[model samples]
Target: MNALQLSGLITAVATAGIVVIGLPLAWLLARRSFPGDVVFETLILLPLVLPPSVVGYYLLIALGDAGPLTSAGVHLLFTWQGAALASTVVGLPLMVKSAKAAIASVDPALENAARVCGSGEWEVFSRITLPLAQRGIAAGTVLGAARAFGEFGATLMVAGSIPGRTQTMPLAIYDAVQAGRYGDAHSLVLLTSVLAFFSLLAVARLEQAGATTPAHGAPAGGV
Candidate 1:
């Protein structure tokens, strides 16, 4: 595939992976309050407020060939995977925060009722809480994916602007501008903006639909 296509694929995969992992972690954190819970939440949400380039720099230090992950024989720098890593790090906080909010919005009493009905912990969560929170989780996942797709600074710092290799849409646009390829840059920018806009629109529609859907006969606001 072309560089743009490859980058898009990598971003999507990485974003999906992060959301999949972060959502469950968010659920755990939201559902169970423990010592240092607030601290854990802050750490999970750290990337949201940090500079993207800073996050990429740290990832490079941790996952580069000569970094701490060297022993694992994984090389992330200047590769599409590196871009994916950067995207994941940058998008993780959004995913976790949205997911945590969604999970938290779920009514604990519903879960408790499920438990009293002899449902196992897994059953209660999967059947009651998960369905109730699916809308939020889906919305969060979409937001995280969009964030990853738009990431520029971090992906550039970690993955470099290697065309047809590590160059994502954002990086491609930047490179085009640097080389004075105004037409190319404009096209890329327009494309990215359109994609992002549609994504947000889709998310809004999903949220509205979710809001209107009956919560399986549960009390209003139970979700």
Candidate 2:
């Protein structure tokens, strides 16, 4: 149960980070065309295709006592923070992908019109673009949260199974299974399935809403 609480905390933190990092990035990817943009995007999306253990392994090297982060006195290995970091890495791509699609669905003419009406870039984004893109942003966050909740390999590599401290739901379930505690595993599995079902449902609804978003201003005058 403590591990489950930790998983909830980690999921919340990691998903929040995903939103903070993903929102601007999504906008950039959807609207910009800079040199090496494709490379940047590919890097962001790489974790989606990469093995979870592989990501965890690198995170270990980067967060280990002898690694750069530890060398700089930022110890995270075998801690809840380390687990959250790993979860963030795995979940970030989902958030960015959804956010990008959502932001892209917004009509450019609305932004241009707002700018022409004396709205600063930031103001236009905050008032018009962000509001219009809210559905996608929210969907991406839910997906990120779901991914973080189920993170196992990367969390294991970064934080290990430290009982009530760093061990999350997935890690706890693994431990129960390895200990031949089938009953415990079965209960955990049921809980996990319930959570996953709701999360997936949210993703589907949000994605559909985002995908079907009409052009900004359609309700008013049609962009």
- Residue pairs with clashing backbones, model 2: none
Q: How close to the true structure is residue 181 of candidate 1, measured as C-alpha lDDT?
A: 96
Candidate 1 lDDT, 55-92, residue by residue in tens: 88888788776787676887778888888878887788
Question: Which residue segments of model 2 deviate by more than 4 Å?
Answer: 211-213, 216-223
In candidate 2, what residue range of length 10 has the lowest lDDT sum? 214-223
Clashes of each: 0, 0
Per-model CA lDDT versus the true structure? 0.83, 0.89
